[model samples]
Target: MNLESLLLNNLHRFPPRVVAWIEKRLKAIPSIRQKIDKEYDDMMGGLESSLKPYKDRFPAFTELPAQGRDRAEILREMEAMQSQEEDRWREGMVSGAVYHGDQAHIDFLNRVYALHSQSNPLHADVWPSATKFEAEIVRMTANMLGGGADVVGTVSSGGTESILLAMKTYRDWGRAKGIRKPEMILPVTA
Candidate 1:
């Protein structure tokens, strides 16, 4: 049998403690560890190509140029890059992307972003406008979801950060309740 099938069969038969011990032993072997690392690197390399198609085509800078690039040149470059990347989504060739992106909606959002570009919600004392916007967004979402007036919400950067914050909250709540260890339930398909 292949090593993977053997490991799978053994894992099914072993208890948690025994499985952990086996895992430790397997990782302790230099060849096995090196093989795992190499496999991970190879997998990431394959993913990187699809993730960053422009990495090879565009000019990359490690440091700022002595003289700043012209504003018109920068705008032209941005437009070129945007056109190249937007076609797939615009034509509905990409999955789970915007259904449509009209010039009016795009222009309005761009203007709004530009107007508030300098505002930092993190520094709420200095940028109360940003904080107010965040609060209103949370309130609207809570209301739309049938949440009561007392319901509170906060914004997160993204899904992974939101999950991490929830996990941390669970850990703390469990500790407060005298539970030494807490378990997080994750979907197998997630």
Candidate 2:
């Protein structure tokens, strides 16, 4: 095992208060803080291209147009782009994505998705169906994970919300144990 794995393993053996004290002192080190910032910037730089593909190709709008663009024209541009771009994913030329590459299945899913395009589970008053679907998914997941009938789960939009929730849970647990500060040590592999 590397130095990080060894350090993390040892850290977990300490009480939470001791771990928090160590982390605070470690963060006070200039070199360690600088290295963390540099690594974070590098990771975000690598993700930027995938997240903002159309930033260079399409005209950006800070506000809506006085009138929307023509539906037919917008669709034609989208279809053209899709035809040229989709082959990469469909042929498995992309990483971290799964594609069936079946046109019929894709078409059926597109139609089904379009039907519910306006749904937002967060606003149950407006989108009761989406709320119901999310509830059912959470219930099924809880059961599959061997949680009892009283166990509850929530469906978050993505990684950011899920991570936030986990961090909050840890913070609350630490507070309950009389630790004002919480520190978590996750394996580098995780």
Highest TM-score: give the candidate number.
Answer: 1
lDDT of 2 by residue, 112-147 (tens): 799999887778999898878888998999989998
RMSD of each: 3.5, 6.8
**lDDT scores for all predictions?**
0.85, 0.83
lDDT of 1: 0.85
Q: Which ten residues in a row have the lowest lDDT in candidate 1?
A: 91-100
Candidate 1 residue lDDT tens string, 17-108? 99999889998999989988999999999999989777887677889999998899889878988888888788777764564489899899
Residue pairs clashing, model 2: none
Off by over 4 Å in 2: 1-56, 99-105, 123-126, 186-190
Give the TM-score of each candidate: 0.72, 0.59
Clash number for candidate 2: 0
Clash pairs for candidate 1 = none
